[model samples]
Target: MPVRREHRTRTATRTNCISAINGTAVGAGDHAAIVWPLLCGVAKAKYYLMTADFIGGREAERIGLVSLCAPRARVLGRVLEVAAQLARGSQTAISGTKKSLSNWMRMAGPIFDNSLVLEMLGFLGPDAREGIGAMRAKRAPEFPSAKLPGAAQ
Candidate 1:
């Protein structure tokens, strides 16, 4: 099935202060293609996105994917502390800074839109079905797109 046109809209911008504890991070959909590059650099983004590797908290912070990594037990407390500090800051200054930085992402709107279209199209192809089947069967995906013409199975 094709993705609905209305569902292809760009994600809304918001102030994100990511903090990770014990869990890992993986970019879903447009996240790897767009958001990851905006947060980290292209090299790091591509490495992680392409591999679909699980990123630990420390690795995530080192790559600039997260603002901080807190001990699992202290995660909630750390989050509240950061929230409190932000709440004390001047809203006008914070809002303006966010808008300025967000313009960088806005500049990539065309690229993001094109990538999104391609990604959605992939969902309608044979590889998508094979991928899902492989996952359900607990086996590595033998993507249809990876098959070469006249190659024996």
Candidate 2:
């Protein structure tokens, strides 16, 4: 499943960009216990390098941070190849191309939001209410008649 985020696009999301980046998260109390003589920023960064792993690495990709993913044995080689490509390519050209793509698809955000609202509205209708109630009650619910009472007249 893709990571749920309001700030990104589907194509922009690669395996790394989801909740795929495995890392340790410390709550308020835990942070105080281990992180001392260090502020929040430093502590967060320290925690990342210390606890990050590949089990669910794509998590971090949700924000367009991770560039690629590979097995432990080949990660370095893949990184090198990616680095070489970037080095050989025109930085400005790539940047502009990506920027345009992002802007064009960004409008999908509001469309999804409206669609979700419409779906929920449907769920709140009598059909949905009957369907859910029937499921919870362990019986099939009856749907309303497809036609109004006087439609054939």
Candidate 3:
């Protein structure tokens, strides 16, 4: 009973936290990360996005993160070409298709909202304090792995 209660409490806390962030659209990309796990079984999406971990264009394309990579010098021309192609297509059909995709993508909104709240909660904790202090002190942040009060066990 205690374990069940703890789980419920933790879930409620998470939901509330996410709700707060969702209200502001601060975690919109989180929905994509959360859904990526469902569609592509990519569990590291959130971690990669949050940590600003960068992959090269080729690697991103290989992983299906991008359709193609353009050389730096040709990027503008490539983009313009794509835009012109899109503009030449049926605008109404393209708009409707985009809306459909957007609606499907929005299924992750709740999860993203929760993640944002958790992130905001982290900002109010010791780790955030230490991080800010380290930044002000001109040192690297030494984030502790210890669990805080509302953190999941």
Candidate 4:
């Protein structure tokens, strides 16, 4: 019973978070449209538009979605403040330095296998028992840590 409530709470949080980032204009299935541009903004190193005056922007900041935050009404003023500072500074040097470092980081590969390992383990783990139970029960998982090697019995 507690697990079901927790599952619904988590799901609602996820859905609300997505809806906050993506306004109703693009609708549900087309959420990817917003995501691609946001990634492009990050790659090009620009501050992407905040979907909501408060909520989505908060989540974005939590996830490195933006460079800074302003009061919900002060966005333009905040932007101008940064722009004027940058305009007066050494733009060429800054641009070149950023380009070089970003390019270097982008090329660092033999891409870490962290993602693949996590996915594999998440599905195959003995610790995943509760998760699979939740899945079969049409609920979210609540696995115990007991199966992990260092966990206390």
Q: When superposed on Cα atoms, how far off is each prediction in RMSD?
A: 4.2, 17.8, 12.1, 14.8
After TM-score superposition, the amount by which residue 102's alpha carbon in candidate 4 deviates from its true location, in angstroms, is 3.3
Q: All candidates' lDDT scores? A: 0.72, 0.49, 0.56, 0.46
- What tens digits encode model 1's per-residue C-alpha lDDT throughout 40-132? 899998888776778888887898887888888988898889888888999889768877776776776677777777887988999899999
lDDT (tens digit, per residue) of candidate 2 on 1-153: 132253454436422222222234333221222222122344444555344433244543432234455566676676677667766778778666767666644545565455456655867788788877888999967756345577783
What's the TM for model 2? 0.31
Q: Write the per-residue lDDT of candidate 4 for residues 66-133, one digit (tens) a residue.
A: 55655657777777776677667686775666565445333422222342344457668765777668
> Which pairs clash inside model 4?
none
Instruction: Return the lDDT, model 2, position 121.
Output: 87
Where is model 2 more than 4 Å wrong at Cα?
A: 1-105, 145-153
* TM accuracy, model 3: 0.59
Predict model 1's lDDT versus the native. 0.72
Who is ahead in lDDT, 1 or 3?
1
lDDT of 1 at 139: 100
TM-score of 4: 0.34
TM-score of each: 0.79, 0.31, 0.59, 0.34
